[model samples]
Target: MRAVLNKIRPKEKEEVASDLKDVFDNFSEDDTINKAKEKLEKFIAKWSDKYLKLSNCFNEVIVEYYFTYIKFSCNIRRMIYTTNSIENLNKKIRKATKNKQSFEKSSRLLDFLFVIIKDFELANTDEISSTCFLFLGGLRHNYRHGPLQEQQS
Candidate 1:
């Protein structure tokens, strides 16, 4: 939304921002999945006649990804779409591997990555929930260390 607002002229930015808030009033984060699409459709229709581009963009990109968080339980909604931490971890992996050039074999790469990523995981485990730690696919936690809850099969 900040990106959208940045495109507006400063003189009218606030007014346009308020108008865009109507999009949220129509279908905010707290909405349930069943009603989300309907409200989104209504918001699109409300603007389609007046602002074709805005509505089209909203429908095509924004509304299309709208169900992303609504599909998850609200407890984990904030964690669903974020990539900053993942990107940071990726940066670390890249930095660690950059000087190595190449691994001798596939297993060598896996072993090297396991150590680096495991270090990153341990570094992050305390900063975030163990449940969200599940984000690190296949980086399983030992039960003795305390899982927020048991992993489901």
Candidate 2:
């Protein structure tokens, strides 16, 4: 996928990426799979002729299972849908392992990776803890006891 994306000129790449984002954003807004499908069809109709390969790739590979994320809670949906953290982790792992030629055993490689990941977790613990506290506080005060809910009631 990255290779295919890289093949596009920079300006066209941005446009294509934005168009793809719109498709996912539409799916995210839908409350039901039927609505999502409808939105997806409309998106496909708009883009399919212009970007046949991308439309075909999504229809063939993604349309089958992407809607399942809608069933999860907002936090879970965010975690599942966004790849930034996972991609960052992958980049770190690649950098850490790039110098090494080989490991005697897969277990040894995993052990090394575990230590690296543990160190990273420790390094970020403070930031993560503060974010968690802020997230919980927001949930309590904003959603549970905010003015919007009062007005709705």
lDDT of each: 0.61, 0.57
- Cα lDDT of model 2 by residue, 63-143, tens digit: 757767777654456555666655665677789999999987664665566555545546666322222323222432222
Clash count of each predicted structure: 0, 0
Model 1, span 113-148: residue lDDT tens: 666666776788754445543444555545345323
> Could you estimate the TM-score for every candidate?
0.58, 0.48
Q: What is the C-alpha RMSD of each candidate to the true structure, in Å?
A: 6.9, 13.8
Q: Which residue pairs in candidate 2 have backbone atoms (N, alpha carbon, C) closer than 3 angstroms, thus clashing?
A: none
The window of 10 residues in a row where model 2 has the poorest summed lDDT is 141-150
TM-score of 2: 0.48
